[model samples]
Target: MGVSVFSLKGKLALITGGGTGIGLGIAKTMIEAGAKVVITGRRETVLQEAVDTLGKNAHYRVNDITEKETLPAMVEDIENSIGPIDILVNNAGTHHKATAQETSDKDFERILQTNVMSVFALTRECARYMLQRKKGSVIMIGSMAGLFGIDKIVAYGTSKTALTGLVNALVTEYSKSNVRVNAIAPGWITSNMFLNAIANDPQRKQQITNRIAMDHFGQTEDIGHAAVFLSSEAAKYITGVVLPVDGGATVNF
Candidate 1:
C-alpha cells in the first residue's frame, strides 16, 4: 500500500484559538484530512460550538493563550490527556488598528503579549515533546500586514513580522531534530470582521481588491487548505519558509 503524503490519518493536531475564524477553519480542514483535532479558546461555549460543528473528530479545550504562565503545564496536560500533538498551530492572535503615533504603549504591549509572546511560549512547550520524538510540525499564522506596508496596524504588523523571525530561528535550532517550523501569511479573507470593516469604508475595500491579483478577497478555506498541506507529511522536507497565501498582493504593483 502506498502511503498518502497528505493523509494525517494517525496524527493529532492542537490549534490555539480554534473556536472561530481562521483557527476554526484550520481545525475543520485538519479533521477532514484525518487528524483528530483539539481546538482551544478562552470561551468554553465557543469551543464547544466549534467541536460540535466539526463532529466526531473534533474536541474542545478551554484555554486563554494570553495566560503565559500557565502555558507549560497546560500544553503538558493536553499532550498527556488528548494525544501527542503531531501538529501545533499557533493561530491565536490579536489585531490592533492604529498608526505608530496613535498606538498607545499599553495597546502595543498587549498586542505583543498576545500575538508574539504567547505564541512563543506555547510553541516552546509543545516543541520539547516533539523534539524527543523527533517528529512534528509547527505552523504559525502570520499576516499580510507583516509582508507589506499596511497602514493603521503598527502594533499588529510588528507582532506578525516577528513570527517570520521566529520561524527562521526555530528551524535553525530544531529542524535537525525533525521538528519543522513554518508560517502562512493569509491574504485579505472574507469574514464578518472584514466585511464590516470594508462596508464602513468602501475605499479601503477597493484598495484591497485592486492590489490582489485575484481581484477578490480569499476564503477561510484557502487558509485551511494551506495549513493542512504544511502540517502533513507532504511538507516533511519543507521548513523555515514564510508562505504568502495572499493572492499575489504582496508582489502586485
Candidate 2:
C-alpha cells in the first residue's frame, strides 16, 4: 500500500532529446514525481520552450547527442552545475525510413553514430560518476522496430536492437556498482507526427490499430510512467530488461 517506493523525490534526472515528444513526456512525469529534471537537445529554442512549460523543477541544456567527443565535458558541467545525475535517459536518436536495399551505407552509419555510438559515449561518461557513487539508473529509449520489425526502417531498427545488447552487457559490469542499465521499447505512441500521418491515410491507421490489442495507440505518458518506475526505487531490482510500453502490439498474431 505504500507508494513511496515509486517516488523520485530528491533525485536528479538527465534526459536527452527532452525538447519534445516522449522525452518531454518523461521530463514532465519525473518533475511531477518530485525529481529535478534537466533536459538536453540540440535546439535551444525548443529546449527553452519545454523547460518553460515544465516550470521550476525543469531545466534545459542544448547539446547535440551526435557530438560524441563533447559528451564528457557536458556531463561534468551538468554534475557541477546541477547535481549528480541519479537517473540518465538516453532518449535522443535519429530515424531513417528506408529499406535495407535503399538505405545507403552513409545513411546507416549516420543512424548508428547518432543512435548507438553517442548513446554509448554518453552512457560511459555518466556511468563513470554513477559507478563511483555506487548508485544510478540508465534508461535507453528503444522502439518496436527493434523488438520486431517494420518496413522502411532498416537502419533505425538496427541501431535500436543494438541497445538491447548494450543494456545486457552494461548490467553485468555496472550492477556490481549498483548502476542499473535498462531500456524501454515504446510502441506506436500517439504524437503529432503519427497523428498527422494517420489522419491523411486512414488505411495505414487501421493497419496499425488492428495490430494493437488494446485497440488504441499508446500515450506519451504511458512511456513516461514506465520510465519513472524504472528510475524509482520501485524497480531497484529490475535491470537489463527491454520493457515494452506497447499496447500488446508486439505480441499480436
**What C-alpha lDDT, on a 0 to 100 scale, does residue 231 get in candidate 1?**
90
State every prediction's TM-score relative to the real structure: 0.97, 0.96
For each candidate in the order shown, give its overall lDDT on alpha carbons. Answer: 0.90, 0.91
Q: Could you tell me the lDDT of residue 52 within candidate 1?
A: 87
List the candidate 1 regions with Cα displacement exceeding 4 Å.
1-3
* Local lDDT at 70 for model 1: 86
lDDT of 1 by residue, 18-119 (tens): 998889888888898999999998999898888889999898778899998888888788788888989999999888766799999999999999999999
lDDT, model 1, position 167: 93
lDDT of 2 by residue, 1-253 (tens): 3899999999999999998999999999999898999999998999999999999989888899898888899899999999999999999888776678999999999999999999999999999899999999999999988898777789999999999999999999999999999899999898764575466668877888888889778988898999999999999999899999889989996
Best by lDDT: 2
Clashing pairs in 1: none
